[model samples]
Target: MRLRALLAERLVSRGLGETRDTRPQASRLPVLVPVGPQEDPVEAEADMRRRLHAVPAGTDLVLRTSGSSTGTGRLVAVSARSLLASARATHARLGAAGRWLLALPAHHVAGLQVLVRSVLAGTAPLVVDTSTGFRVPALADTLHRALRGRDPVYLSLVPTQLVRALQDEEATRALRQVDALLLGGAAASTALLSRARAAGIPVVTTYGASETAGGCVYDGLPLDGVEVALDAEDRVLLRGPVLASGYVGAEPGGGACDVGQDTRYHDVSLAGGTGQGIARQEGGTPLWRPGSRLPVTLRPGFHLLPTALPGELPAKGGTGTVRVLATPDRGRLEEGRLVVLGRADGLINTGGVKVDPGDVEDALTGIEGVAEACVVGVPDQEWGTVVAAAVVLQPGAALDGAAVRRCARELLEGSHAPKCVEVLDSLPLRGPGKVDRRAVQLLLSRS
Candidate 1:
């Protein structure tokens, strides 16, 4: 609390309130300890004095976060310029920027980007306090307030919040008022997306991490100045102005900028205008651009953990259409669009056959009585890791484990079938809308 107060003043004074790193620990501000609301004024001031001395004279804004893929934390020095570049690219893709309802926690990159966008748009974000907890009424109220203004309204949310919002009639109506509701954090199930679209919601699926300064790709296509490609291992690689400078105490490619070729960057333009295309392939996988080799030029973007590439690369000779082969969980690029498969880590291995939990979860959700489902790999002596499912049945609906297993087996391979099903009131969630996969596995383990 004391740290935010001290850092907030320093940032606002420098017009960096929307862009600077606010983590005192990463910044080495040991004096600014966490304080409650009732702390004495004198003590707070003394702490502030120490903090002022600790902060270097012309320090750049550095935000620190744990890598979503690797689970390792690092400090990222983000510049006001980089924030603006990211914001501009998003706005260019979304068409306009106006009043934004800040629903996410202010500490994370997703939440901070809302403020950054507001700053770039010369508007204040209508904040939805999550201290009490995220509720549909709170989101609706904040949206109502932001909509009263003439400027366009935007909202950001995780899948969990969207799910709750869809359940409430008032919240669903409020969502339609916004120009775009950016949905990311976790992959939204097909059932969830279908429900949102059915309700006339302008929900834009976003893909990006903290390294890229929030969502760089809206609905699979990279924003202006952003480029998305695949490495030989099929890992998604991003390059653009929004890319972070690099991790604070790391080597080259260790989450920071390049060491030797800092200034030399590839001038590859977005091959197709507006970065849109279509494709038709001989066998599902889009053929490599004819006679075109992966360029040696330096394109600046962070490498993502996902191993899916754009369906069609810029080929030597090609028309607007191309086709790309897709695996079960790793999505394929098709008709110039990237389809995201669920997390690769979530794949369940049973008896030497790999089963995508999402594929099984999709099947479970499609069942009449199942409201939601989360599948995890449970340790089994015979199969190595058997698939287990935690299911949440709809209100007033009853389902048996055998029925769910039978239905899944019908739709999926026998190895992909769940060995056990634990019906629960609700699946455990770690964040706003992310299912606690680890917790689900633990729950099934104990059961």
Candidate 2:
């Protein structure tokens, strides 16, 4: 049997049996499932059975999207060919040829890609427990163990994991031990990436999804056979060998090829909030729109665009197409290097203007007594929303809301200035470096 067929067979035998049916199963995998710290193989098996029941027979493709909390939750269908192509493309791009530390959940495409790459490379991946979230201190030990074999060790981490690793001195040191670290899943804050680079961590930003098997674009460049294009709307679209086949629960005639004109192109629009475009054909020609009406463009054969429309209009008023596709949520491609903004979700829309909280945080990084800061939009009747900042002070340092606000005004426009500031010993971080915006909202609500 061909390698693709063998892979399909293996995938079917290993919890993907539901894909073998031609008719869709009654119940499919939940689009989102949150796994706790403990692993229950029996429960997992049962869940897999339930999920498999939803897919059609002879369907080897499976689609999984990201959940609200990060990790694995979304489900999309992908063909074995797409998965293999993605693995091969990643291996070729990274030139990976050794053991890898798998700290992400197996249900996630990123984590699953690591496993698939390991198998393709004829090496077993070193698994780690990410059920309780990323434990950087513990991961340090795992990294050490994975490196003992003298094989070129590689690992993938989200910004949250990178932040935690940076917090631990040992883990920071351990980062240098790997051949490469693919930092992705979401945008890494500028502060976080700066710290990682300063620590001499060989980190590369990656972009892709289950549709592409894994990371199809590394550091703003497409992998071999992966093509990236931007539509008139500035949304990013992708076409390549690594693209997935389709989605599991997608409406009939809803695959990537249904967008407009051709299957070779897809639409990806950032402005639409779908974070992906549509694949359509016009006059037998394929065209991709970056910004689609859907909240997310999932399914195989459709690739997320690499570029987004500029958040703000250019200063000179020169006319250019502004499109938005979802990937690398923070940074953008400026010149050639990826210049990261903070987070799209982190942007504080105040008075009809979007303000990246990181912009404020970055300007205040060197302030006399500020240790860390988070900026958020607070509800205000006067203005649609007012800019609010939460600051963590350094030990033995004195700072006040007025002082911080004044400082912010000096560094930012009046429109971006903070109306209220709160001082704290430390900001609440969700996983590692991620500021819990919801918690921040709650903090202000009580204040």
Candidate 3:
């Protein structure tokens, strides 16, 4: 409620339950409630009015998460305390509380948190017109206005947006002026990170989902009062004040409720892979020996899992860190810090061998002519699922499917190479401009 007062013009509320939504039902948690600039003008204004004025006090907020690797979305009941806690940790970690440029969609956590961070920082975030979707000129203009303010400015962007920002001189110039740029939403490529650093943009890679109230980990370090751990399976686990209260049950005919105890959770872990630094007992308990294990190295093309040592857990309403329930990601421990890998669900099983699509995509994107690439598993009678890819090439560059596959073979395992490749003008995107893997698979199927 205090956050509402801070952001007078920006309304925080649940999605309007529009029929044509792209995210799965369970994954639609209202983390940072967006003002739906993409919606019909009349409808968007009406929804904003309802959230701004009609919602009663003591009314709970119901938000859905973007379904994890399992493809099932969960509805969560998040409190103002948790949302604020998440924002406070981020602001503290960055060591600066200033204006944030809201470039992401309000409907998703990354975008909504920009506004939330602004509220906690007591600063007004300059919002860009994402109604036409994220564009270079729009982002540049917003960044310029945000920088004009007295307070330092920050921006949160998905990897896709950053990629676009790097293409244009004006956008790149404006982006470089921000105090800090929080990059998350999806795993950023090494090349992308290098480019950002080269451009002198202060980029902080973040790791967290809607469940943890945005990103609990900044630059692979857990935010203050936040706890990051690994499960027996090497999956990442998060616990802290930033954690959401837990999920809510679906409505009778299919919808989410604002309040419910039927689905309160303690911890959740995603399926994780093995790592070099991991030492497990016979019965499967991880033993941590930081910096004493294998060189703390990660494979070039393959995704690695991050391991963790146990940390202090806080009591309810107490002034300590929360506990990890579970997460869908995999990562490893580097010295004392947490290192995240790609999601376990992103792994593809072909011919009884596990292959990471992320690795394949990494290989594809690294190719000279490829601007972006998304690799997915398509149903195959022979191999259970065969690797397929959708790629977007840079302007004036010509790349055939054979060249794409050839590039993957050079960087990835033969099995990891795409069995089929589809060249497109652009990759399909979903929530907050993240690549839509499901939609990419659909494109592969159609071809």
| Whole-model alpha-carbon lDDT for candidate 2 | 0.60
Q: Summarize candidate 1's per-residue lDDT along 205-236 as a digit string, tens digits.
A: 99776567788778977788766554233334
Root-mean-square deviation of each candidate, in angstroms? Answer: 10.1, 10.4, 10.7
Q: Tens digit of lDDT per residue, candidate 3, span 174-220?
A: 88888899999888877778888999999999998776778888988
What is the Cα-based TM-score of model 1? 0.71
Ordered from best to worst TM-score, the candidate numbers read 3, 1, 2
Q: By how many angstroms RMSD does model 2 differ from the true structure?
A: 10.4
> How many clashes show up per model?
19, 55, 32
lDDT, candidates in the order shown: 0.63, 0.60, 0.65
Q: Which stretches of candidate 3 lie over 4 Å from their true place?
A: 1-35, 39-60, 68-72, 250-323
The top-ranked prediction according to lDDT is 3
Lowest summed lDDT across 10 adjacent residues in model 1 is found at 320-329
| Per-model TM against the reference | 0.71, 0.66, 0.75
Best by TM-score: 3
Q: Whose TM-score is higher: candidate 1's or candidate 2's?
A: 1
